[model samples]
Target: MKIPAANRSFFLFLFPLFFVFHGFVRNARFIRVTDCLVLTGAYFLAALILYLLFYALLRNSINAALVASFVMAFYLFFGFIHDPLRKHSIFLHRYSILLPVFLGLTVLLTLYLRKKAPFTRLSLYLNLLFLLSILYDGATLTWQSLQSRSPRFSTVAVFSEGQPACDTCAKPDIYLLVFDEYTGSRTLRDVYHYDNHGLDSFLEAQGFHIQGKSRSNYWFTSFSMASMLNMSYLNGISHPQALTSDDYTNVWEPLRKSEVVNSLIAKGYDIVNLSPFDLPGHPSTVSQPFIATNTKLITYHTLADYLERDFGYVLQRFIPRASKLGNVYKTNETVISRTIQASSLHPARPRFIYMHVALPHSPFLFDSSLHRRSPEATNVDFRLKDYLDYLPYTNLQAKQLITAIKGNSGGKAVILFMSDHGVRAWHDVSDFSYFFNNQNAVYFPDRGYSCLYDSISNVNQFRVVFNKLFRSNLPLLRDSTIFLQDSE
Candidate 1:
């Protein structure tokens, strides 16, 4: 019934290696091939070293390697299971420090028993099952890697380049500002019961045109921005609804080359990107330099790195910090500061500035005057007060930014303000009205464009702007909304 000592030793090492490999597959979009190789190789080398150490420590018992592998596998399994899903009510308070201590003692006890008891038939069967599981995981990873490389268009050009008559006229700088998860006026009044008339009044006073009831082409940020920037729905890509992260990158890589950006470039406009979306190459932070060489399309390099990122949520439960770099408050500050800088700079050449600011969103941390709110909402359910209070702060920041831009441009710039999607999907699950309704407004330099209507959507924002400035006859597309559940 006993298996070879070498066989048992190898099984222990392979089990953890395979578990980590399976995790890497799950987050294949976030991980790189070089990172995968390095992490896997590192773990294998660590296991080999532990195996040799255990061989000498346990009187040449291969079970020593099994003990080391078991501990490593246990830690990986615990992290994978407990980190992400812990936010749900079902997993709340289910884990404790004692749990890990107990697991360690159990592993030591197993090694102690193996020293006295003879290897049994059950042990051999268990080893075989582990081997089969490892092979299955490897197969799954191979299939996912193949799927990631599936064919899709790199770019979808919507407009043909043409010479414009406005070449002789003074070029007006354009601004596309995305205020994340800011609901429409109706939703603000009815659902959230907070009148946004103050902000609407401010925009009107600033010589801006407001679209009262407008929706985005897509519900999410990446998809919605990509559509607006490209001036086309993702219809060019096959099965756009079922796209993975890899598929998203395939379409998103052409953001700079999109018809909208290219048309501006042809008109002698420099593109200024002020979002993490254009990370590594061109993040438009006011003081920070963009380092393109040593960065990633996605920040996560391995499963461990992704899991470590989630530890902030757990840490927030015990330790309360006023504001961290990536927190919503700090992000809003950076967005506002960068926008102010971009506005005041008043660059010599005409510029197309696009800023995606994540505010009036989650981690509702700010009051009307940029003061910190209670950190208790850090782990609690969404509250109407939090969203409403944060709304005024967003309004203040946007107003300040717009005023600066207008002052710098001498009232000669074109500005478009909108949101990716609305809020309250978490509160009112059945009524997706709030989710579809988004905030939209625009400011034309000459006050000459009269075709803009109240029902115009975000998808057509750039289309109208381009038609006005470049004389490109890009027709507006019909607006539609899609509601997707988490399962989708």
Candidate 2:
């Protein structure tokens, strides 16, 4: 069927709108729907401006719409085209070679459209195609949202109301400080050849028990943390195969509504989320570092993102704020300050503060002197030496943070300091077992450290805590590590 000329120009706007919606739908699990609002409005405005400019030049609405569609497609899909070509051929990756090719194609398309009659049939096909694509994504997003609202698992079911609790037990302020990518002391000594005994001794002197052979139950943060907080292995809550799936809603749902957190809340404990990501009811105190909350698929894969990944050190010299490395520095600084403030709060109810500090992870931003390293010095190579130098800075910060917490809480707080996983960036290493070796330490005011063992994985950390502190007889799962295919 042939469409009327009056509606042919509408496809130009529909294509751009579809582009934005498609990207949002792909990343909806990580980001919120409202996060894409500004970007959608911007794409529509750009499409309108391009259509008006092309119509003024071509003197035909259908011809102008076709040209605008071609431009929008090229602009939005540049990164997708560049990434694969760059991996295979150097010449094909260069903007000097690719940009001119796109320009020439656009020019030839314009000349062809000028000679031919207005293609109303092509416009109708595109309009139907884009409309169908948009509806599909919208439906998928709505179904996922409804599923999330009614999750398969509930907090009430996880922590039964009949579970035992100690009414007379002293509920000291509990703190779980998770340091991302801090390898175990053994890994530091054998792999990196750096002795982390100083930090261990400091923790021991301050009434902390350091687990020498600690390992994470899972390699990825979401899986490890979800298992840790829920006090169950991945197979218990959801399918073990879901660990490899791209969609993390199953893992993240259990994490957000953790049984440990819910049980604490039920016992009159305040929850403080000072982490990089949100928890059940509380949002993150600081903004997430590299990826902003409003990030979408197209925004993350733009030409600028490729440049930042490849040539960020050089660009940082010119525009320091533009670098994501700089953002990591700012985020770590804010997390430290805010954590200290949260510790000092003397609330009547005992508090459970979850402070996840992303340090010694990536974007090695600090030196041994506690000064921000120069942009040129920021190592993307993930070298062992770079990691060793950065570890001392983290150690210093950890010491200061622990001391402040002890002082503010009057030596009456239970602190659990551990890492999500070990150093995962060492690509050349052969033996991958060290990837699970993470740092684990705990400080209990009552000096009850007998229940803790040497090789306790993250999945059993909270179980021991609950049994010791609240008399909650949660059975300790076997300490074992399930290595996933991908670390991230």
Candidate 3:
């Protein structure tokens, strides 16, 4: 097509600019300046290919080229329409009809617009609209970037006692295994009506002292973990209302850069972090082969959850293969696999393994027998049955981890098994009780120091451990629990 050089340049830049804008918005958390440059370059290449094809198709008709570019720009910028198409499953089952109708409408609109306007007039209007949209998107991105750099609300600092000493001849390897949203046997039996005796018996027989009436210090993962790891209640140092806010910077800071981890490292222990969470100080033992081992992907798993809620069903109809990626039921089998590796016998430094297993938590992937549940069986609002259904899989994996670590450690390791919180189904008032009822168990080496009580809260866990093992005088903080509703 014999398009003006100005018009051709405008069309070429617009689509790639739109791509760059949207890509940056979607990936702002992980995107670096370098990444932005690469994304712009990639989209430019794509835009060039499309421009060549459209030029060839127009066959020297300047009007056709102008209209085609406008139509293409419309479709590219309005791709959010694809989201609505995916969100509704009923339309997708009959996508045979719906898809064709949509395509026909688009084609008809393009044809009408082409014949209605001269090339120069249409190009001028499109260029103006494109410039406005690009400016708006670019401005918004810049504002957000600046806002994210603003100083976050600071909270209390994490306090620690003197350096923990290894009183024993050899410092035992430490394992802190956390299963997300897992409740104790009491809650399992009383509320869920599921007897978790088998796993309890297995641990008991293996010499673990189970804290039967154990509770968590805080109501949620971030708060509970921060308290437990730092060995004190968050309210002690941080503002009393800090937990009421979702700003977990105080919690995350101590977790990623924890004195507990540092103390162990100073004492010749290698920190092995196997959680999917991006705790940058410690290297991950698991291989994240799916997502490139980058800072953005791991830290932003919540985005996947957001997509599934908004577009999962619709996506399933079009790209059935991509359903797994959208499936909230999917487990991090790689975590289990790598944990097994971490627990294996190797001639290395004494290790402290921190593993966060996010299963038996949501989408209720597995049944009582560790088999993946059918999609039909899965529910958005998982019930007690759904929670019970996942027990077998997690139980099996938990047993395997315990056995592997014990076998590898040669009777010289301390294993602490706990949950960040209990069953979080907020439907029933009584469900709140289980929220505080956490699963807690510890296996100290050679039937070592036993100050374990039946009613210990997570905050006092490491305090007791350091007191007994390291001969430190860390006092037990009084146990407490708070029922969290929201960030309000």
Candidate 4:
């Protein structure tokens, strides 16, 4: 009885465990063990199949198992580490457990089914699968992009009908400013109508005509920005998954060459980007370069990137917000400060400055000093109440940025202000039901007067801006598939 070679992929058994455990222990959530078992069995079986796949490729049974295990781990980590099931909106107890488990099982079955596994044959098969998956992903993404609907808004008002003469003749240097989670005016008016007046008035004073019904298409920044920047209407997107062979991959379509940035550049405007989420290697960093007309974009990468490049993440698990607290800063306020710098550069061309700010996005820490709590488990005194309570300073910082931008633009700039998405299912929209529901943007903190999601979503945000900026009589995208105003 000879002992078998060490199958390196044996660790693939842990792939299912990692995903199952990920949901079980994220940010503190509760799940049943039945769900756990289902996941475990599903993933284990999947690993078995992938192991055989290795058997065919590598004459060494051990090496074959290792190859399969590597693939299993890659998917498990991609799904678990990045998209913590508990934190995701789609995380259903039974499905979250069963689904990932099923994926693991599928891969295992694939590995097991390969005939009389020889290293050469098995490697060829694995290589083919990898190449096909990549090509399919690319082609499908391209088609979806081309098929996506173009955005235009529905409105009674004709903004393009009138334009007061300003020999400043600087092609309406568009400054599409999106303040992450900066809920829109229409949202406040409909939901928290009473409290919304202040915001409404401010926009009016700034010459911004808030579309009382302006809605967004998608909830997340990635989808929403794609639609807004391209000036197209996107209803929603289906993310790709590959648990079963039929379960194909889906992705966001890339913007066409005719979109805003290119159109602007073609019409002679320079583009500069500023995304607060810019932490080294952020998709935006790689992506913005493609869509951007100029490379002057200022981005912070990610909080971790900021922490590593600047200070140490002493508060890695439990951390502090980088808000100002009268000097002696731990992590300097990099996000806001960078935006101000970007704004100054805008005046140089018929410039298009897109600032994706994320201070208000999350880790919900708005403090001048260190975060309210630490990992010590002691009463860190940092109450969770309004962790983003530093909105005033946030607002002030915004004000300073705007002031600086205005000065540089010579006081003439069309600033399209909006939020990428909503507060993370907590804080202001802290109601468990409201936060967790499909609703992303809500009228909370008392709806501030009017709520947006119940009335309209991000589906139609860019239409109003394009109409306002380009001055189209048919300003609002009237053809939106969503029958606005009577979806009731």
Which candidate ranks first by TM-score, i.e. highest? Answer: 2
As for model 3, its CA RMSD to the true structure in angstroms is 6.4
Tell me how far the alpha carbon of residue 199 in candidate 3 is from the true structure, in angstroms, after superposition: 1.0
Cα RMSD for candidates in order = 6.8, 4.2, 6.4, 13.4
Cα lDDT of model 1 by residue, 1-488, tens digit: 34237564556666656655665555554344676667667777767666666655665445665556655655555544554555464443254553566467865756685565434454576567778887887788778667756324443454636545475566888888888889888788877678899999999999998888888877776666667777777654555446554554554454434666766776778888776454213433422111111123322333343433434445544554432313545556777787778887767799888787766776666765668665554435677677778887788878888998899878988898889888855755467656878989889987775868877777788888777776667778888775543322
State residue 131's C-alpha deviation in candidate 4, in Å: 10
lDDT of each: 0.65, 0.78, 0.65, 0.43
Residues forming the 10-long window of minimal summed lDDT in candidate 4: 242-251
Lowest lDDT sum, 10 consecutive residues, model 2, at 241-250
Candidate 3 accuracy as TM-score: 0.70
User: Per-residue lDDT for 1-488 in model 4, tens only?
Assistant: 34245333334454455445433332011133565577568777777777655655555664556566566655554434433544565444244564576578656755564444435455445445545554564565456457645322211322222434334333656666666655444433343332445445544554444544434554445445555555555433322221221111011232322255554555457666555222111223222211211111111222233333233234433343332121112222444465567666644457666665553443334443334433233113333334334344445555566656666666566665566554333334433222111112211111132222233334444444343444332333442322111111
Predicted candidate 2 versus true structure: per-residue lDDT over 1-488, tens digit per residue: 33234366777878878877877676565556665677778878887777777777676788888998888887777787996888777687798888888889988988888888888888888888888989998998788777735544333247635678688989999999988889999888887678899999999999999898899988877778877888877554444444433334445667667788888888889999887555777655666555333353447566566667767788678877767666666777788888899889898999999988778887878777778788877846677777778898999889999999999998899999899999985564688889999999999998889999999999889889989998888887788888676322
Using TM-score as the measure, name the better of candidate 1 and candidate 3. 1
Residue-level error in angstroms, candidate 3, position 31? 6.1
Q: What TM-scores do the predictions have?
A: 0.72, 0.87, 0.70, 0.48
In candidate 3, position 73 carries an lDDT of 49
Cα error, residue 462 of model 2, in Å, equals 0.7
lDDT of 3 by residue, 96-160 (tens): 66446656865675556445534665566666777887888888878877784522322234334
